[model samples]
Target: MILKKGQLSDAILILLILLFLFTPLGFYAKVQLMRLFSFAPSIEKQETSQKLTDYNWQLVDVEGNQSNFSINRGEVIIINHWATWCPPCIAEMPSLVALHEDYGEKVRFIFLANDDSEKVRSYLNKKDYAIPVFFENTQTPTALKASSLPTTYILDKKGNIVLKEIGAADWNAKAVKDLLDTLLVEH
Candidate 1:
């Protein structure tokens, strides 16, 4: 059927609106899609010979207790910088939880939420995530600051950044576990 000019423009506008609503708008959606197709952690192996920055970054637990990552020395460290409102962050939490279950005793998993304690606590409570959750109690070190949501840093016992992944990833994958196992052995 033939359509009037004004009607055609209105139809195009509606189509565009729908597209925007359904498509990935921000970095979060793009990361989420990337995680869905690849269930393994996107690991960029760093040279173990290189030294990592000191773990003096301060963080506060949900109870307001102060601590620094230095306390977890001599163990593999997994620090995840995430936020509640980030879709990619939420998407990869399950894998993190599972990864914790498998390696919680051997590895130190620290989830650093860029959000407030109340929001993070509420989110964790609702989701029943048992991993340690902390909020930044002081200015985050430039090295620790994430360029994007869902960034993760895996450190060996010597505090060297072994893997620095910038997007959501499947933390429970065998490769991830294998890497953790290797790190555990080296320590």
Candidate 2:
């Protein structure tokens, strides 16, 4: 049977539309279309390294005592970069404390505040938490290059980064616990 011109054109158009919406190529096409319409791509997180040596983070204790990362080199370290003003960071404080209670001795948990040490002390003064606190004026760690607040860096015993998470997360979650367990085993 012979098809009319309009029918054949409609069939081809349907095929193209389906192909344009169902694959990786389709996603690219959508991106290109949005670009042509003057839309910008969503911002992506900056990539960070997974090696502890990549970042020379200064160490500290709850009393704001300065130290070296080497002191905790032989143990797994959970480096939490936080600020008092950050709501999510504040919200995750209890979870972090709970995490410390469960694995504090096994792993070296450090809460590195990007604010003044006094500010951190004042904040913790009201809480019954037991996590060690430290202060870092310059927040440039190779393993944690995140420009966002509430970033948690999980480092192995040798200080190598095992995982980097941005935004607030339940530290007691199984995924996080499993990852920390693996790092502890490596230690």
Candidate with maximal lDDT? 1
The segments of candidate 1 whose C-alpha lies over 4 angstroms from its true place after superposition are: 1-35, 44-50
- Tell me how far the alpha carbon of residue 61 in candidate 1 is from the true structure, in angstroms, after superposition: 0.8
Counting clashing residue pairs in each candidate, in order, gives 0, 2
lDDT of 2 by residue, 1-187 (tens): 8889999999999888888877656655654453344311122233434566644556666664667665776788787888876656775666678888888888888787778777777778877566788766445565556578778877777766666767666676656667667767763
Model 2 lowest lDDT segment of ten: 37-46
Candidate 1 lDDT by residue in tens digits, 32-88 = 675676468655565665455666777889888899867987778898999987777
- TM for every model, in the order presented, reads 0.80, 0.66
C-alpha RMSD in Å of predicted model 2 compared with the true structure:
14.2
Per-model CA lDDT versus the true structure: 0.81, 0.68
lDDT of model 2 at position 3? 80
TM-score of 1: 0.80
